[model samples]
Target chain A: MPYDKIILGAGLYGLYAAQKCGAAGQRVLVLERDPGPFMRATYINQARVHMGYHYPRSYSTAIKSAHYFQRFCRDYGFCLHTQFDQIYATSAHFSWTNAAEFRHFCRAAGIRCDDVSPSRYFNPGMCDGAFLTTEYTYDAQVLKNWFLTELTKLPGVEILYSHRPDKIEAVGDVWRVTAGEITAEAPFLLNATYAGVNDIHAMLGLPSFQIKYEKCEMILCEVDERLKNVGITVMDGPFFSLMPFGQTGLHSLTSVTFTPHETSYDPVATFPCQQQSEGRCAPGNLFNCNECPAKPASAWPYMSQLARKYLKEEYRFRYKRSMFSMKPILKASEIDDSRPTVVRVMHRNPTLVSVLSGKINTVYDLDEVLQQ
Target chain B: MITNKEKNFVSAVVYLHNDGGRAVEFFRRVTAVLDQHFDQYELVAVDDACTDNTVDSLRSWAAGQAKPLTVLHMSLYQGLEPCMNAGLDAAIGDYVYEFDSTAMPYQPELIFEAYQTALRGNDIISVCPTHTSGSSRLFYRVFNANSHSAYQLRTDAFRLVTRRAINRVHASSENLPYRKAAYAASGLKMADLEFEGRMGDKGTGRLALAADSLALYTDAGYKVSAGVAIVMMVLALIELAYTLVIFCAGHPIEGWTTMMFVLTLGFAGVFAVLTIVVKYLSLLVDLTFKKQKYLVESIEKIQK
Candidate 1:
């Protein structure tokens, strides 16, 4: 029989949704543009499962995340890296939540919080208050494999690797999905394409979303000594982190506010939804996706300056490789980073469910979104 | 003899189910908290047919109290939903405080603050949870997201309700198997007093309880499943269109026509059967639990 649901994008949100639907006895098929999972934003971003420390301005957002942090641990504990204590220290400048307010929020949210002596942790002049949180990081590859294994165990679930959906049509009450020469039809269609959400919507002649993409880069560094798996984050401002990068001894140094390239909707303006924009690369209107640099441009030096300010032993951090990524964020979440997974069902056609993916820890939100 | 002052008294309803040693401490703490807040009040403790000495401990504590004490014992272990209904029926107070006996040593000050919040034109004052089981949190989100009713769900089991709100909850809960669901859907003006709840001593079948309550009150999962099935059947009609187009276009693949026909028909048949099964299953559950919605075996008043 034709699959009951066809989910586009095999990112964390898409894979998680497929597993949930398949378990519920719905025949599900997941299509990934990439050959495998975690080739895009899911792989390149800082893997910290936020626990209300990042968002001090939005209480509801902080509290909702508190639930996600615990839920992620309970559901996927084996895939998590808890080798080091994750600290949320407030920087001296451009900080949204100071030391005292952040501590109060942690207590109200029922998160375990402990104060760290400035002399003992971080550069003494870099931060005023340093506190420990229950947040942890997960290896993207391990998480991807875990989801894929669960999905394969289900009877009618199928994963189409490297299948790029080029067309989606609302044929009568069901959706007809066309990828390359292959065609599939399902009653419900969930567009969880993340950064490519607007791309599919544009192809289907649907209205555009208030979503934008930012070219982000993470500076991977090789530390002389292991940091005891402790992931460090300095608020949401221009700060750097020396966190355990998966199972490797190397750490991923990232900044929320700083990136190699300025955040843009499209580097090449022709295909706005494709996020491939070139700046005066050709004589005519011929656009090229390769015009944009695939690797980070001078991301290491900038990261090193911020790292030195925050860490006492900055000299131990050696540059490895910078990974370039596109961050898909809602226009609203750009301010406070608070919007969770939003399932926008086309009011005219309720059969098509478009899920704007949020935090990685909240992958379970797929169950709730599908139910809606 | 009930005096004019005691006639319109505040009532505190406590639920004790298999809670053994904590019952006496619970009674003492509840009464002490009540005395500091109200001039005239009564206690209505519902014992859900405990096998332990919880009833004896409660009875001994009631003998020493001057305020009115009523204990409603169920003939069977009717669970918290029905036990709450019985307590609500027996409580004759101007306002009512409903909380679990194992609710961590609730300071009288928070109770008074809740009362004051209610006095300031709020119909319902509830203590919201700072921490709860992950399943319980998911239940609230699912219920709220799918709920068409006006009442929004909260994670607070501890509540102080005015007489009007209490009446609304009682009236609305008469037909439902879940009391908290009914109360949330009762269309009452409610406000939450945020508090970090301590974990209870006993680990009840909370996951099962939450699932059962959600299925009874909000058929969110069932509705989504049925909707999905209906859409699938509709999609089968569209697949029929594709089959014809491909056939007329002289499809390259052999036996494609028969495969499409069987696939379309088979999915439609499965969905039709699945929808019917879910419908009847919901009815069966409702009919089975129809009698136990508010069943109370006996009630006894202990006073000097």
Candidate 2:
């Protein structure tokens, strides 16, 4: 039997590719190793629907991804929760200084950016409030679930569980793939795993490189009540913005830099582990999550001091429940394979395309790459 | 019974007044302590809409006293905010301080000090009549560490906001009062004096109960249970670690050679596993709690 397309991974992006292929009434095969789509990495991300901060970082890709995400939610009937435009501090200037003009940029793009006053912390005088394009943060798991739940029923789309793909090779005119145990052939292969694609790229002898993933472990302070009588999402600064997650009464927070790239998968990096769990012992290392015995987090060296200052009083905000960590792509390296130019006889080939979807902050120069 | 030597005083906003238990006794003490200096001042009692004999006792006390003591009652029990607003509206004194019926040996002089401080600075919003027990502070120190990493990014954005700057933090379609710290800055200056041997448990949020109890107990309104979360997380990590072992070992024997059927599932499996792993790690280090910005805590349909 001939398969039209074979996609690796069932993440939102991979599923999307499958659905697209399946729509053509083509045989679509989706292989996922994890039990189901409920836990796809991107689905488990901050669930922060990107607004339009991408213009300042990487105008083109930000626009494309933002447009894609917004439309995807609209098309799929997913309720993305977001307040108005975001808030930035006049007190500080980040790598990009013209942040104030982001409102105009949004306006020119037919989006809204209404300015308002800053609350006590930001506004002792209360003067800074602006409404720009808002990010729609939905339950990423829910959306992923919806897609899996809905798309699995589509015609010609076959979703297999416990199937791990091993390698891909182009035999004759058709592309042959050896995944788990079966060797199958298809015309086209689309690789979109944020990190897993590197292995496939390597298998294809395609220059695929792994960009380090930085994970910031955090506990969400579940908001006990609404922000009191007001319906404003509270965001504090520039690079990191903390808002209230819907219904969960949790703050969609932004405070620490998640250096997942440098983060190790060792059990020693378990302070954050214990902190993630019911704390083992209190104040063992109140200043640092890393030093906390029975519970420690391996973050910045200075993070402990910060933990002492800010995290010390976290219980003040009603801890309804906690969500998971959010991962952003920090670097995307170009893939280059250097094999002596061989005639068509001694064969070798590299993977054709690699697609990535992550927070806009990491796409420093996306158009430049996409164009390349 | 009008002691001419009594210190001048104003009204008190009583909190957690269920049935106004011991209101009469508290008023009797108030009269004895400040009766001399407080002649024209009225005793404004925020009834908190107590279900007990609070209103009757105040009226009975009013009838006998040469001074007029009025009760500002709530139609429905609205919580500390409405009770405070009602008291603030009714208070006719130069000073208004929170008076807890359950107050623990608080010197009458402390209230007087708050009054003095208010008189000294019009910008002083309110005084911390009570000090957080050192134990409470320690809990917060730990709490702060957990939350700081999460909020550090945004706090830095607003760090330069001046006292007069107007930054409005809105949550549920309405504006909150300057994010809690706004009260800390807006004409509300708090001073902590030593209330020796007392654990600062006046009305509701008395943290003087135990040392680590503050961290564990969501008694007042702290909905974010770091303790519970911590427990759930450990279980999740264990599950995740096992899953990781399964994934890395590539042990599941299910044959997946049929390319189209399971291609995506394989990669997605790793993705899911990574999520569990990453999220598990983030638990201990989570600094800021989600503001619980959506749920309207007051809109609960409590039966009257």
A-chain TM-score of every model: 0.89, 0.67
TM-score (chain B) for candidate 1 is: 0.82
Candidate closest to the true structure, highest lDDT? 1
Q: iRMSD per model?
A: 30.2, 20.2
Pairs of residues clashing in candidate 1: A84-A229, A84-A230, A267-A277, A268-A276, A268-A277, A268-A278
For model 1, the local distance difference test gives: 0.69
Q: lDDT by residue for model 1 over A226-257, one digit each (tens)?
A: 35556677774546677777665668888654
Q: Model 2, B70-103: lDDT tens per residue?
A: 4554556655544543443333343455453434
Candidate 1, B1-304: lDDT as tens digits = 4432222357788888988888778777777867765656778888888999989987888887876577887778766756776676555566788875565634656776787788888887877667766766677888887777666776675788776765466433434456666666667777888775644432465666666666666766578667777776677767767677777888748447657776867777687667756765875667455633555555666754
TM-score of model number 1: 0.51
Scanning candidate 1 chain A in windows of ten residues, the lowest lDDT window is A281-290
Deviation in angstroms for A86 in model 1? 1.0
How do the residues A284-318 of candidate 2 rate in per-residue lDDT, one tens digit apiece? Answer: 11112222233323322222221212211222343
Instruction: Candidate 2: give the TM-score of chain A.
Output: 0.67
Error of 1 at B74 (Å): 70
